[model samples]
Target chain A: MAEIQLKDLAHSYAADPEHTTDYAIHQMNHVWEQGGAYALLGPSGCGKSTLLNIISGLVKPSHGSVLFDGVVMNDISPQDRNIAQVFQFPVIYDSMTVYDNLAFPLRNMKVIESEVDEKVRAVADILELNSILQQKANNLSADQKQKISMGRGLVRDDVSAILFDEPLTVIDPNLKWKLRRKLKQIHERYNLTMVYVTHDQLEASTFADKIALMYEGKIVQFGTPRELFENPNHTFVGYFIGSPGMNLLEIEVTAEGAKMGEITVCLNDQQRRLLKSAGNASLKLGIRPEFVQLSSQSNDESMPCTLVHTEDLGTYKIVTVMLGEHSIKVRLDEEQQVPEQNAYLNFPSQWLKFYADDYLIVTDETGDKS
Target chain B: MNKIQNNRAWFLVLPVFILVAFSAIIPLMTVVNYSVQDIFDQNNAYFVGVEWYRDVLQDPRLQDSLLRQFMYSGSVLAIEIPLGIAVALMMPTRGAMASLSLILLAIPLLIPWNVVGTIWQIFARADIGLLGYAINGMGIEYNYATNATDAWLTVVLMDVWHWTSLIALLCYSGLRAIPDAYYQAAKIDRASDWAIFKYIQLPKLKGVLIIGVLLRFMDSFMIYTEPFVLTGGGPGNSTTFLSQTLTKMAIGQFDIGPAAAFSMIYFLIVLLVSWLFFTTISQLDKNKT
Candidate 1:
């Protein structure tokens, strides 16, 4: 296995890209640690697939080099890269049986027949496809076909990494869970570096140790799921990660505190200092709906907002409150009480994230940009 | 639990019944009637048993034409299928170039059968045409009008030009239907070019190729127009396919009995061969053993 490094990588579908918007992937550097499970998470058309393809040498980046371990691999083709990739849809050779589909890669590399059979059988065993190994790949269900696709990568012993591009999109919910668990088990057993690309936050969070949140052709944040939830480094992550996501309001930074229009909302001492230091940049105050508390009556620490609506989710409730002209969502536990009237929104200072020009500006306790 | 049965659906089939009777069944039965009998006129007829069938089968002209038809159809399929697939492979897959290539390929298919015949007839003329003049200029004795080999060559080449596009179009559509992911996966797996074709492209193109093969076989077996116009079954009937022979006996000679029997045999051969092609190729994947 190898640590995949994308250094100064930029990709543009256009022959002459005039602006940053034309690039599918903007110039950036990132590294996937050897044997670590990482995810490229983003919404559709955010270049996650492009990044995965670039890593696999399927698509060449317009600028910069891809390094496997430490060697530059710019001119290396996908065939020479020793990378394995599972695609968005299950791709199998219909003329071949399940066994042959799994055995194909090893056979291509001129591995011996007995070794091919051993590896194929082992992978089939892990995917629980042993029973139908002799059957034609065309006859299997979507999930089993997908398993065959995944099995091809697993059968190869010398692959540097296995890339998955939304492999479970066609699978049913129950099978998706099983296949994901199987993938995790395979990772644990082989210690292969894996990068899964998906639009789904849940799939990203559950499958990868560190999720790289991408937006507008850039990696906005790369951290654990909890880190992304607790300390979103970008405004997009703050909006993208949670269920209702972090409620945000355009705020003006001042000497007293952050102001959301005429009323000034109270911020913690550290946050107030951070906002003041990040001067002249457009400011936004963000807090997860889960962190926002609802007070029955207005208080000095609370902002007065009208209770617009409440949605009763099975485990929790999301209440929408109109704070001036902005609608902010406040999530409450099933047992927690919502105000009858005169709702006051309390922004817990610790949970609040301040953004200057759409970037998270929070510093950890040690004065580091964590 | 008991379910109520509705017979109303059976009554709804009346329109289809009327359509099939007029279009297929009644006409087919009339041919069968004509094939088994000797009829001098509307008022005079006699049941001749299998006499006409036996006579038609023994006729050497009919036999020669059948053999020529088989060779022609075989040669057409052998040349066209691979060539069509190659052309399809070379075609652009997307964007403005793909659309332009598609339009250019469709030009041959859009020409009517007779028009194709007329075009090739003048185009292959030894004295005036470019192809014939160039071949002769290359120190080759080529005149489709007088030589049997030359006539056969022109007829086959004309047929290829007229119909290879159909197979190519079908194959192009088939190739386009395959996702880019297959090619990417193949590259990642380190599959050779030949291996990719053998495993991925060929297998995916199987369904469309079956249709292409069947259509090409049937159409080539019944080929009459371009050859008729270009060579006129000339050079001692070297290019006379089965349909030309059937047309000659039925309409040219007006021999009602044997011609009907000959036409009947022609129909059966096409039906049987089409059925064989369909079943054999369709079952190729299913019966792996």
Candidate 2:
């Protein structure tokens, strides 16, 4: 196993990238520690796959370098890098038996036949594919085929890392969960560095110890799932992580206080000073929907909001409330009652986050100003 | 729940039945009738009772031509399949060069069979032809008119030139149909070039190879026009195939009775071999799965 590092790595599919938008993967420095299970998470076309490909040595970056164990690996071939990649679609030798498919990588390295057989069997046993080892790979179910694809990677002991580019995409839903758990187990048993690229937050959170959230070809944030949920560094993260996501409202800073229409929000002295320094820059108040307290009676810190709709989602309810011109979603518990016409919505001070120019302003443990 | 039996479906199929009978069945029945009878004139004919079939089957001339047909078909398939696959593999996968290669390779296939034979006939002439003259200049006696080896080589070469492109095109299409993921996976697996070809490419090409093999086999087995135009079944009948022998018997000698019988046997042979080919390949496919 090796620590894979990207030293200001950037990639572009174009022959000449004239602008930042032209790059598929924007320049960034990141490291995946040895034996760490990391997920590269992003929306589609957000460069997660491109970053994964760069790490696997499939695509040469247009700028910077990829280093494995502190050694430059940009010029190395994928095979020489000793990295295994399971693609989005299951790729197997259609004519080969399941056993042979698992044994392929080992055989390619000229590993001894007996040892190859041993390794293949061990991988098959782990994948629960021993029963169909003699069966041709072409005839298996989609999930089983994907398992065989994963088995090919697992069978090779010399691989420094295994990269998965949404390898569970073609699998059935139930099987996807099972296979993900199996992969987690495999990662623990082998202590192999695995970098999973996916757009799914749930999958990333479950599979990875830390997730690198990419946006517009740049890694916007890299942290644990809890960190991402609790303290998103970018407005996109705030809007992307949760079910209904964090509710963001445009708040204009005035001499009196932060103002949202006629409702004046009470802010501390530091916040008022930061807002004053922020000048005319666009500022937003971000609070998770779960943290939005809804009550029938108005209070000192509460703003009156008209209830537009309430969706009972069995476990919890998503209540969309109109606060002046802004539509704010408040996630309420199953037992929480919705006000008939209007309600008082309160943004808890601790959970309240402030953003200037669409980026979360770094704050200390105690929520403060900029 | 009981299923409904639709007797009205036969009425719906009546038009197709008549069309097939007129197009295929009636003509085949006529051949069958001729094969079973010794026709002396327009009306006067005698019941042969498989007499013609016996004569044709035991005939040494037919046997020799049959063996020659098998050898020619087998040799052509053996040579063309590998050669076509190699040509396809060597071809550019994309861009202007791929299009140019495809157009260039398709030229020989576009030429008519008789025209190909005629072209080769003039092209391989000992005195004036470029090929024969070049061979003679290299101190090799290469007269296709009198030498059996030269005639056979010319015929096979001409066949290869005319048909290898068809196989190549099919194989090219097959190769193109394989996704890029397989290649990437193979690369990551550290598979050797030969191993990739053997394990990945060759197996993927099986579906198209089956079609190529069947087409080349059936076409080569019944080949008459090319050799007839070039060699005229001469050079001591060294290049005479079954179709040429059948054509000679039916049209040259007008031995309709034995020729018709031979035609039936030939049809059966082609059908049986095709069935065997399909079944064997399908069995191999099943065994793998």
Best by lDDT: 2
Q: Give all candidate RMSDs, comma-separated.
A: 2.2, 1.9
* Per-residue C-alpha lDDT of model 2 across residues B42-134, encoded as one tens digit per residue: 889999889999999999999999999999999999899999999999999999999999999999989988899899999999999999999
Model 2's interface RMSD: 0.8
Model 2 lDDT, residue A224, Cα: 91
lDDT value, residue A131 of candidate 1: 91
Worst 10 residues of 1 chain A by lDDT: A361-370
The DockQ assigned to candidate 1 is 0.72
lDDT of 2: 0.91
Task: Please give, for residues B1-289, the per-residue lDDT of candidate 1 as tens digits.
Answer: 8988899878899999999999998998887788899998889899998999999999999999999999999998999999999999999888999999888889999998888888877887789988888889899999988999998888888788878888899999999899999999999888998999999999989989988999999899988887887778988888888888888888998887888888889989999999987888768867872
Model 2 chain B, TM?
Answer: 0.97
**Across residues A63-124, which tens digit of lDDT does each residue of candidate 2 receive?**
99999999999999998998899999999999899999999999999999999999998998
Candidate 1 Cα errors over 4 Å, as ranges: A254-256, A297-300, A363-368, B1-11, B95-100, B125-129
